[model samples]
Target: MDLKLVILFLFPVVIGSLGNLSLLCHSVFLYCSGHRSRSIDVIVRHLTVANTLFLLSRGIPQIMAAFGKQDFLNNVGCKLVFYLQVTAKGVSVSTTCMLSVFQAITISPRSCGWAELKLKAAKHIGRSVIMFWVLHMLLNIRVPIIVSDKRNNTNIMNIIDFQYCSVMISSKEKTTTFVALTLSHDILCLKLMIWSSSSMIFILYRHKKRTQHIHHSSISSRASPETRASQSILILVCTFVSFYALSSLMYVWFSLYIKAAWWLVKTSALTNAGFPTVSPFILMTREQFVCESTRKK
Candidate 1:
């Protein structure tokens, strides 16, 4: 294994693991401290776990392969790793969408339709999270069936791809149908996130203008906590969209060209790992507990 490849895989794994773990610990601490966990907090706790699982499932296998342990994963190992990675990724996407939508509803005017959803959503957060896990697990069940350990054949030209597992589809129709379903699910989640984030931004802008008009020269020096939290969530959404786009593009390209160059495949993996690595820190910055903990320290 090349030293550079090891660093590429290991760096994100360590950073992502630490970030997610910190967020998880902080969330747990807040919940255990008799604080009423808000809907967003519950969603965030789940997101942190999903992100950690995503990093572990996706990064560990790559790191093992990079360290000259290609055979470390057998058929079952490949299936388990790939399946877990895909499911975790779906959960991450779903939780992020939920976060955006929850915040949008929280900040909406009382007369708005979203306000109506806020109460019911709060009550069903646990059930929604369970459904997310179940839906993704069922959606990606074909992953384990399709993925297997790559066979080593001395006769064929060996083009090293970053993926350790080879995907086998019994029929083109089944592959097409699976791809379509997966794409539809991802696009729907992305649309929901984009819509919620855009609405939040518009609402914030209108509120700011109204505040300026009412307060005239005496506008406050600092933004309210709600405004700050909304801005942070918006930034998080934008970051996720950017990383998700890059990852999706790479996935499509790699799918079309299975023999993609090693560096290209490595780049794809990095993009896939980007959001989980950075999002936790973004979230932590907006967390009140993190601020309180820091001051105490």
Candidate 2:
């Protein structure tokens, strides 16, 4: 591979892996040190694991391919890598939506409907996490069945084509069905995230106004940890939406013109890796635990 392509593929791997690993380690340290863990911490820890897996599964193979290491992965290898990548992506999306909803519930007033969910939500966090994994795994089972290494195929013809992996769809009907299902799933998750984030923002705005009217000068004092965390969650949601939109547009273009230019594919891959690469740093900046841990060390 050329220097540019190598850097393009490897940068996300290094940054994302290191950042997420650090988050995971810090979360573990907090748990071991008897720092009472919040629900957000549990979700963030899971998010870090999913992001780390995403970086490894999605970034490494692309980097290897960029370096002209075509034969490094075989049919089974492609299946596993793509399967894990898709599954991790699904987990990431679902977990983010859950985080948004959880935060909204956390910050909602006692008289609100969201407040009613708080106790039930807290109790089901573990089960919900497990369900996210299981549901994504089941949904993406077709990935392994359809994906195969593209290294040895010289005269391949297909409805959909990829460089490192080929997805074999036998019929247009099946292709449409798969695409529709995937799109529907993504749309549902995105809608939930947007709704939850917007609700949180509105709630925060109302609270700020109410506080200002009540205390006139205690506005700064009203900025609780929950408020800070909500802002961070909003930033995270916006970041994910921006990157997801760009990557999805590229994907649509690729689908329409399967023989898209090489640079377009690289850009798509980079954008696909963008969220996982940057999300940990956003959390690190917003969360106090990371800073406190650094100070202690």
Candidate 3:
């Protein structure tokens, strides 16, 4: 096994796993402490939970592979890992988009006529989360059908043949179908992300500018809880976009330019494998838990 690939896989797994745990612990602490949790907190908790599951699914198998241990996984293991990995990743992206949309409305001005609208919208947070899960489940049901744990007898043995589960793109016919569906999904996700981010940026820029103009010194006094929450969601939105863009680029490259190379598999795996690890730091940096009890010294 390549040491570099092993490192790339494990680094994100270890760090992301811990980060998600921390976020979950802190979120629970705040909720228990009666902080009157907002919609963003719920979103953060959901994102953290999904990211944690994603790390577990992707990380454990990579570790086993590095050690040349096939007994650690089987067909069932492959399917379980693939299912969690896909579902968690899709949920994470959807939640980030939801968070951005939630923030844009939360911070909208009263006179701009969106303040009342915000109250009526996203009122049912539970329903929103359920919708995300249901949609992701529907999107990823193809995993069981497409992924298989079959081996090849060729002298140039594929390392992933031992245990891998992904959308099979073997034949040209299948490739066309996969590419068309993937592009349609990507465009829809990208459109939603862009729309949400743009809305938040517009509302936030106006809010910040108006506050600055009113009292330059007061602007520095302190940020409200809502501002901090919005900032955290924005950071997540940016990170989510960056990861999605990188993954999409790799997908295009593998589909178009480098389909023959073993490196394509490695690259695709690595692209997806980074998000579980990178996301937690963004949340930590946003200091979302500062108001909670666990972080207080």
Error of 1 at 69 (Å): 1.3
Between which residue pairs do clashes occur in model 1? none
* Residue 54's lDDT in candidate 2: 92
Which tens-of-lDDT digit does each residue in 80-165 have in candidate 1?
98899999999999999999988888889887566667888899998998899999999999988767777642233423344576
lDDT top scorer: 1
lDDT of each: 0.83, 0.81, 0.70
At residue 186, give the lDDT of candidate 2.
Answer: 84
lDDT of 2 by residue, 1-297 (tens): 766787988999999999999988988998899877776778888889999999899888778777877678889988999898999988998888888888888878887665668888998998888899999899888888767777645565653445677766456687678778888988998998989888898999998877776654555564755577678888989999999899889968866664667778678778889999999988886577334444546
Error of 2 at 219 (Å): 4.9
Off by over 4 Å in 3: 111-113, 151-167, 170-182, 215-225, 256-260, 287-297
lDDT of 3 by residue, 85-187 (tens): 8888888887777767777777777765686677666577668877888878887776765554543222332223423432344567866875676567667
- What's the distance in Å from true for residue 281, model 2? 1.3
TM-score of each: 0.90, 0.90, 0.83
Give the local distance difference test score of model 3.
0.70
Q: What's the true lDDT of residue 47 in model 3?
A: 88
Off by over 4 Å in 2: 159-162, 214-222, 289-297
Q: Which of candidates 1 and 2 is the stronger one according to lDDT?
A: 1
